[model samples]
Target chain A: TQLLEQSPQFLSIQEGENLTVYCNSSSVFSSLQWYRQEPGEGPVLLVTVVTGGEVKKLKRLTFQFGDARKDSSLHITAAQPGDTGLYLCAGVKNSGGSNYKLTFGKGTLLTVNP
Target chain B: DAGITQSPRHKVTETGTPVTLRCHQTENHRYMYWYRQDPGHGLRLIHYSYGVKDTDKGEVSDGYSVSRSKTEDFLLTLESATSSQTSVYFCAIGNTGSPDTQYFGPGTRLTVL
Candidate 1:
């Protein structure tokens, strides 16, 4: 199984509608980061949640980290067409032996049509 | 957009041929990483470097290798390309350790026939 799994593999909704993307994992992480990617481009960092139970807001986006640091969620309020993209959540694990790599989820493809 | 530039933005090569993709960073960040994106696989790290000549394998390192002879350049090479190796590759740089924000390069799309 993938270390990180994102739910609602695909989502389509009308403009001004709300949506949520989830990322879950069986292992704990030191931090979790969210990124968004448009077609034919690299993913762009949206936000990073470090402490457990942390909540961050970026304009119409709200991000929350699970208390166990094993999962995260991203909520979009009144999404717009401009918000259409692939949402990915990556969890970072420090293996204690000079190894720290981020495990990425399959991603949630969201389309907000006008 | 992170002062990172990947060479050969797009390429089509044949299986059994060798290919090299370059990732150059002007930010002089200490951490550098190479990842590949596929349909069902979001982004899998192929390799990463902490400093010059210091590299480590990632989850999807098979069929791929990397070198960091210089701090600014990280190279991902397919010694003998295979059709399964075809995917869009990305390079990223970060100032600190994991969990730190990473700036990504415009990705290089490769097709192995």
Candidate 2:
């Protein structure tokens, strides 16, 4: 089984503080995705990185894929209270014959205090 | 938001009872997946369907079963509910062209006591 290890299971910081979350795995993945889930709701996709050493930015969030495709990072700049939620990283492996499955990390819960 | 909906957004039942969760989608996507989220376990896939009447087990499919009789509807059944099965269930639809990107439903919260 492929497992994703996420660092800093819990984080709490002031509104203007910047933070970063990391996800690492020993197995290589075809693609990696990041999601943010709020209380009482399903997770929403934040970004998908498919290439090695790739970086994508979404407003205040920046996502990067490792050079080996086995790790990813999410960095938030000047976070706000609205950015508080659970962040999840998912890795997809090609199962061949139109079958691809995703393995998710335990997730990092962030609390941005006002 | 995606055109996905889940019935019985919240449910409470006792152990040894049978429970079924429904997922309906209007996107007409070819792939659908069922996952359960628990504390410290993240979201684990229970089952997935590739097409009508075609389904496959996922990593945590031991105590769960799924049926996809039609393209728009997928059902997950717990033959005998247990306390361990109490978790938030999420249904997701995958794009045909991009299998990695999935749009999830609102989710169903099931509690078994």
TM-score per candidate: 0.95, 0.98
lDDT of 2 by residue, A1-114 (tens): 999999889999999999999999999999999999999888999999999999999999999999999999999999999999999999999776766899999999999999
Positional deviation of B98 in candidate 2, in angstroms? Answer: 1.4
Query: B-chain TM-score, every candidate?
Result: 0.95, 0.98
Q: What does the i-RMS of model 2 come to? A: 0.9
lDDT of 2 by residue, B1-113 (tens): 88999998999999999999999999999999999999999999999999999999998998899999999999999999999999999999986688788999999999999
Evaluated with DockQ, which candidate comes out highest? Answer: 2
Instruction: Name the lDDT value of residue B88 in candidate 2.
Output: 96
**Could you give the C-alpha RMSD of every candidate to the true structure, in order shown?**
1.6, 0.7
